[model samples]
Target: MKKLILIIGLASAALTFNSCERDITSLNEDPKHPTVVPSGVLFASAEHALLDQVLSASVNRNITRFFTQQWAETVYVDESNYNMTARPIPRNHYNRMMASASAVINSPGVLSALRDARKFLEDEGVGAVKKNNNIAMIELVNVYAWANLVDTYGDIPYFGALKATAENPGNAEIPYDDAKTIYLDLIKRIDAAVAMINISEPGYSNDLIYKGDMDKWKKMGNSLKFRLAVTLADVEPALAKTYAEAAFNAGLFTDKSDNFGLQTFPSGLLSNPVYQDVIQSGRNDFLPSDVLVNFMNSKSDPRRDVWFTKVAGLYVGGSYGDENTFSDFSHFTNAISGENAQGFLLDYSEIMFLKTEAAARGFSVGGTATDLYSDAIKASMTEYGINDTTATAYIAANPFDAVNWKKSIGEQAWVAMFNKGFQAWNFTRRLDFPVFTNPAGSLVEGVPVRMFYSDQEYLLNATYVKAAAQKIGGDKVTTKIFWDKF
Candidate 1:
């Protein structure tokens, strides 16, 4: 009887297993949620990731504005005082610039997403012309991301960056590459990307910057190349002149219409980063610095009205690095504080300023230094809705000081780049203008020249990180970047 019962139980178990085993894979698949994302989606993700790194004012992510003394902290003054270890700022930026495919699939980074998007296009057998345009866009974005990384932290992991593949999983421990070498290569990459572009054909449909407009993409590519060339003007003047001239000759940002950004972002989860920091965060933690406000106040800059709200009918700013009350000083105007403020990666005003600098350096970039300088300020004024007459009068009042071009151009560029901190920092560093002293109670001896390498690198890639630190003459905040040779 026991044997018979055992047989019956075994038979029953087998019957149940058979019923569940036949082609149940389809049942496990979710039709509503896709495992593979579209290439356009990946491209768009890359765009946002890049923008966040450059545009965010979050202390944990970006503090360039504070370093350059454009904005001051109200409550948490650690960042304002150049505290690197307190937050994972360098790590955040480094990871965003280059991350693994598996990691990017979860949290998209600039290079990783672009890598994935390129792979997707190839796998799907996209048409040749369309694919070329798409690849051009991808290459341009990649060049920008790489250039920004080099600018932020000199001698980064470039050659082996994003090289993890199925056959070579051991490629994760990448080696560091020289910043100047990387910059030179990046300029070449930009040229190649521009060459690949077929402007007549459609490109990325999910593009956040240009929205499938290859013409605008082409302009941005040249503009970006021009920017890189100008950045190397101090260190590699001949190469800089050659590239800058070529870039301008190819094409550049014609006006604000050619601006590269998502100007109109919807509120809620996808609200602008500036709005997130200033308003949506439910904290009044930032105020314009006296360094900026006093300068603008002295000039009687018209954009002050568009950018800030007056405190007691006067534009007062918080002292740099000192703790101050939020309501006691001027706050961002509704135009900036509101949900749908502009967030640009590159703009005409910036390109014009670059042209101004290029011309000042005697590089053939079309116009005279004074004329380009005037155009740049006019572009800034036009962007803020100030009339052409006001811009003309303002230009007249503060004419370009070609004798002290660095001071004149640098100060105005700093003002024009109010919320655009990274670019402002670059201009300040390259031109060495407006003279920044260390913030009160600063962590380091002087203002940071370059951000320290990510702390995680020392742990994971100890040997490489140590080697890089040694090569760049220590990873201190005061360590100047390769292109920042004064």
Candidate 2:
């Protein structure tokens, strides 16, 4: 009888429609959930979320490692075989982009953070130089979020994404921007970000990536500019050259110390994504791909030991699209096993390789292809803790193939970025070297060049989503994204 009365009471309360006059009191404020948080807090959350996107190795969703062939699956070979849509990778990323990333732009907390920071600076009589520097620093984080969106999905919500409802009441769908236009705009924003940097201004102490170091942030901004510039090298040589030279002059990652990546914590839910997936999850779903281990073994590359643990004195790997026993194949070494493993967004080795490629095309990115090529290899070696003597010997053995510098540089870059599968995949798509074989007669199609837009997105904005798919060659995994101009 008491339970029945409680149910009746719940239904009665649910049916009672309270108007603003009666219910607009403290009822709206839930003690457990605050309506307001710090902007620094929101920024930190977004950064942490972005790190998850970068370090994602989940077989069901992530396609990056599959694209790079760095690691392969032991079971559930769908991702390794290029079956992206079979899972929710696109939806997951799209949601992250729409929610967490968009919050950086739309949330009141973030807006207040930026506004209050600028106001504080203004009140301190901090000149325009410092103020602009501060704004640029924040904008750098914005561009980083934007870059991930562009690189993964190609055309996406840009001009109208995340606008306030007042700006566009009942806004159901946002328009999309093509990759080319997005790239150009990002370059412009980066240029602004770099220009506004006044080292004298204080860096945001809440910054997790650079710890409020304006110089490091400045290098990262310039590095990003150059990376974007290089991505357009094939289709827009003029702009590519302009931005490349500008980025070079502006400065870039001089060493491994300058890499723009997250140094994950040793505790809590914030452990390195790879470590979280592999260790804490207690799942050995992945092993080194045969393509990766064989390539390393073919040249006796010392990075093999640094990257993987030998199984029975052999650095063996599974064939693409095939499964191997967890113990039969080499597993990832301690380099990426710890909670504190560094998850790099961009690294010095990649910058060196980019310079090598630019020099190959006579873009004057500092030195000959060979010089930059050697330095790139050495940088990778140094980053992996290989000694100077060993690095020099390896470089001596593998002089830049003057006859085929493109393949040489591309292949070397491919090896240098062992764990960073996203950039590795992008470099492969752009450079088109070390051409990989299709996943050994996988049940699905060939390796995906780009991911498919989710059906949910399609249904939500069928017209524009379909238009994007049509523009990008029918939304298939086989379709090459813009800048993948092979």
Candidate 3:
């Protein structure tokens, strides 16, 4: 009897083990689920969420600020040994901007999100839902992407974005399109987006950027269009005049209230990445270039105090080459304090400068070049909490030169763009006004016209990069884009 009972128990245990194994095998055979949809993550309401990540990862904060000052032609090189003559960083703002543009253009998920938004507008007739908000989001992404592409590579994959693939890939070897063509397409897209806004629909919810405000989005779309129109003043005067007139007539950003930007706080993961790094390491990698510090100092610009902090009684900044050095810098502490800083997308001052340039170029805008230029200066100072008295004095001291309109326009725009590297980089390449000298040890000589095709592209998209290089004349760092002909 005992032997029989033992045999039954052994058989039962075998059966149980087999059953468990079969179940486990069945589970393993099923396909694994994707972690989450890409659109859900990439299409967040906060426009700056992706931007912040890309900026922090690609360009160190100190480095970006230095590039801004340098490219805008606002600063001068004072350190000779450091070669303050070389390109600041090989993959500084220009490279990062190009990479980000490619990601946005190539990502299937982002393309789908944009298409869905557009379809929603068409089906819902702009008023059936919060159509305008969706349009705004689409326009924001497109505008940002277009601006980045133009600023970096000059001609880029614009109309064929998301359509280029291994099969049926038109322009897989994208030849550099004229800057004029790219700008025109951007304008058309912006107009279509603005037209979709219907005030009656439910506004955007979960909007991380504007927090469901359709009116603000409308203003932003118009303001951005105006900014783009103004950018073409030097290259395409007739089209620039037409677009500027249209944008102004359509109601462009009128004040700081109309500025489109995101305010980053210190509490969450969303805090300014630059501030986070500074606080975490207590080392500020950036030093203010003598070029920038002296420029502001020469004009007695009160913005110096607002933009930088004093250290050891000297208005010192983190020098470009002082990253690993232990030397005490003047201006701001090389230490990255966790100070709250806002990441501006498009500011009133930038818009003002654009208008100033357009007006100076004889566009039929409501303001004169001097009017727009002075307003830009005042707006910049006011934004930084600089006293009005100081702004007035600076303006008076550095009067606008009508004969040298480009010089005046470029200088003021550079100053206004203080920490905004994207704008500074674009202005520098497009206008070449502020006349920046290369930093010491730059691999490429003279102003780098185009960013070296990224290593990732070389490794993954070798064929595509090769084709693009061929079209643009060469894959070298010194290859000039079409618009660099200033």
Candidate 4:
């Protein structure tokens, strides 16, 4: 009887151990739950929340750097307002951002987080947790995505954000939203965010963008609204005027201090990704453009010195191409090993230029065109250490003639946006200013209007691509966005 009892005890112990092993194995097997919290947050943020704001900030800044290089001038991708060395493969910010956004957008878990925001708001009540904070974040995310999509593809999925679920299903294969529809939706989302915000409560915490500052978020929202309205000026002038007036009444970014931007860290893995890549890898691949260099030189603009370094009395920069080819001209061929390199989303100078353009167009946004234009110019010069005398002199010599003002606006904005590709690309598309003559040997056949749908989109979302093509009139390089009106 004693032997039988001991056998039974041992059997029970073995069963318990097996059960524990099963639980441990299951934890490792689960693919849906990400291992890291910050990674999860970043994934969610990239797709449904505010990833592009950060990603584009980095990527656009780099593009500006590239434009300052030789290729933009020789090929005419951007008119060289600044003389540069050679062009590099337009750094892949769009690819990286798109990949991150796509991973979250296509994932079921991330989608649930986005959908849960609505429920959390409902349960907590709009005012209880300052519901507008959540709404504002969501609105900002959607707007960023929309801007990126349209800027890259002209038209894309706008209304079907988190709404496209199993029930009340939207066409995953939905057609592209017209530019007009997209702009209208952007305004509506901004309005909703503004209305939902209750500045009385303690603000949000995990908000990586504004960090619980409802007032600043409101300012950003208003500024974004103004930006969208201005983008539509060529396509729908009447509506644009109304929205611009509303933005002005709401109060736009008042100063550089009020500018919406991301502050990158000096070190740690999360330090500005661009700075990390460029510094560590010795991969400074972009060169300044000749068109820009000539323009700056003509005005005796002092910013040139701050932006580019002189090698043997010639402003030199790296080139974009295969590793073998790039090695020929680029000086820094190893990882970047310095500090102080960082990224910015939007700056005071950019906001100033927006206002300058609005004033130039007589859009009823208070401020004289010349004053705003001069302010924008000076702000840019200050960034590059061009003294006040030079800045003032450049402004005086450049003046604000309608024809010349348009050219100056494009050139100045382009210079300010140096290293930021999407902004330059967006500005080029909307205004077609700076009238850059294309380089003789661009790999891209012509100035590409939008990026080709990612390989993943081509394979997995082919149906959606086909439908989008039908709506946008062929998903090719030439298909213009609604605002393009080409």
Candidate 5:
């Protein structure tokens, strides 16, 4: 009889077995393992994997916090200095998004699992309304993953990725897709997904973000559309303006309550990834970076009171990429470092800031740039629990700088996006604000504009990867993503 081993929560699992029939083909069937997994389980697992990879502070998988200089390494500073090869960071992220092979628990990946869920949902012949809403939710998540991949790597195997078959195995070489083309298509997908969301019906019941709340899902879809439009402002201004306005017309996150967030479990494999990295790891390799803290300190940002702990009665950060004593630097607050802390995917604060940028660029996104900017800051302050008086005062002091709106919006967006490393990195790259200097002993001369394609891709799909590298002007860390035209 074939043996089945189930792995659970980053640990080993052993299954009890009974004697099987004598037939060889019968031995292959494991009763404990079902041919089809419930769509909800696959969807939920996919969501967890997506959030864990994106929201994690793990040096091995993700280090965007260091890349954006929001956090600095205390000892092993390779990642902080733009070293892409020390670990398979890009590979881990890539796998989290597109890996097709299923684990013992039916967890494929973000795209793979969601695609599988769609297939299973179709196979089961669910009701039209429920199925449409479920499929829409899946598409929304797919769009988010695809956008993230395009933003990280200049080009990727889009149409060819996550589609393994009997004739075409998972390891088959796939051609790279143009990033701009992919972004345009993703915007279309978002629009379709939003259109399909029947608020009166239900969504994925196992959803970690909204718990079958199709209304919130619909809002998030439009919110995502607006964010993507803003990303294209420098590259596709007219298209960007049209979509931004369309997204506003559709609707968006009305307030903080509509933010897309994942609450951390109390314990086990489902615990907060941040808490796992900072507290459970039994290491002190990371601390807030001076690049961030000094900026926050300079503006007398009220959110700082709740973000970091005081050292010597003042919020102090470690010099970016420098080795420092763990006890000497300010640590992240309990609100962030606690085991049950929540990690956000999309925030109303971010949408408001996008609106601010859109208004600044002459897009009719519903308000003046100055008013929207203040609203963005106020939303961020409220999200962090700062009083209205303090928030208003801060906004008054740092009034919008129309001449340098990018700097004004980008810098504050960076602050507002604390702990959301990926979006913050996007802000820094697109807006080119709060300029970061190359860390001492760095791999590149300056901050990396895009993450290099996974090294494993070179070994596994050499020809296609080489073609992609050449198309993107070499697979170096300095290569800029398509939308980062500024």
Candidate 6:
């Protein structure tokens, strides 16, 4: 009787195993999710990732703004006083951007994917037929990312940046490439992108920057060329002139309508990064720097209201190099409020200023230096929704000084570029304008020229990072990037 009972129990267990094993294959696939995301979706993911990194409040993002004296901190005086290395800012920036770029490139046939994505929109009855427009768009975005990397860290992995493949996983530990060579390659890539875009491809669907507008992307690529060229003006003047003329011929941004950038979503993960820092984080950290506000106040700058928030019904800024109470200082304007904030990766105002400088240097930029300078200021004012009458009055009141064009152009550009701390920093560093000075005990010897590679690079890529550091005069903030001759 015991043997019979054990046999029955064993048979029951076997039946249970068979039931669990039946059709397990069907359970492995989820119908609601995708194993391979559509190419357009992948591109959108890359866009969000890049913007998030560039716009975030970490040392990687806003620290440069402080370097340019656009912002100050109330409590976190360390960042405002130039202490970016206290955190893993450099490594984090590189890693995050590389990952984002990989997300776009990993899609099989990256260039082809761009075409296919636009084609899909065409099928949806919302896009125009264009040959490889998406490819140019992808290349343009890549140029911006690489440019930022080269500007921040002098020698970074250029050729091997996204070259990792199945056969050699080790390529992920990319060797640092020469900055000058990388800049040249970037110029080539931008020109190639401009050549590939089709103006006939009227509209797009998946585009986050230019809204599938081929013309705007074309303008952006060339405008970026102008910026990169001007940056090299000090170190390689001949190369700078060659590329600057090319970009000018290609056509830089003519107005705000030609601008290409990310817009702030009202809520959710897609909300503006600065808005996240301002509202969602519930942290009172940022203040308008005294350098910025005082300068604006002195000039009666029309865009001041558009650039800053009011405190006690008045505009005020926090003193630089000092810890001030957050509530006592003015914050950013309502345009940056969580519900309606938008930030540009590049803008018309900046491009106009670039033209002003290029024309002053005797480039065939097709406009007088004074007219370009005045137009740049007006473009900035109009961008912030300031009235035309006020812009005209401001431009009239503040006449352009031909004798001191460098200082005048630099200072005015610095003012117009109120929120773009990185671009403003580059302008200030290159032109040595507006006269930024740190308090005697600031953590920097003076304005930092470049950032140190993060400790992670020293640990994992020590041989390459060390060699690159030695080549560029030690891995310190004081060491200038190759293009920063100032």
The numbered model that scores best in lDDT is: 1
Give the per-residue Cα lDDT of candidate 2 at 227.
87
- Per-residue lDDT of candidate 3, residues 36-130 (tens digit): 22221223412433355334512321233444443111122322222222443333333333332233222222233343334334544434456
The TM-scores, one per candidate, come to: 0.91, 0.87, 0.77, 0.75, 0.93, 0.85
Candidate 4 lDDT by residue in tens digits, 235-344: 88888889887987897777555556554333543344545544544544334444555666676666666665555665444323212233223232112113344344
Stretches off by above 4 angstroms in model 1 are 1-35, 100-106
Write down the lDDT of every candidate, Cα atoms only. 0.82, 0.71, 0.57, 0.53, 0.81, 0.71
**Model 6 collision count:** 0
Candidate 5, 1-486: lDDT as tens digits = 011111222111111111111111232376554545567666776677788778889888788887788998888889988787878788877776776331122224577667666766777677899889998989988999999999999899898776655455445677889999999999999988888888897877777778889999999999999999999999999999999999999898989889877644556666789999999999998888899999999989887789899998999999887788889989998778788887888889899989999999999978999999999999999887888899999999999999999999999999998999998988889999878888878987668888888877887778988999999988888888988886
Shift of residue 320 alpha carbon in model 4, Å: 8.5
The candidate maximizing TM-score is 5
Question: What clash count does candidate 1 reach?
Answer: 0
Better of 4 and 6 by TM-score: 6
Q: Model 4 off-target regions past 4 Å?
A: 1-129, 161-172, 317-342, 383-387
lDDT of 2 at 208: 62
**What lDDT is reached at residue 463 by model 2?**
77
What TM-score does structure 2 among the candidates reach? 0.87
Error of 3 at 275 (Å): 1.0
Provide the global lDDT of candidate 5 against the true structure: 0.81
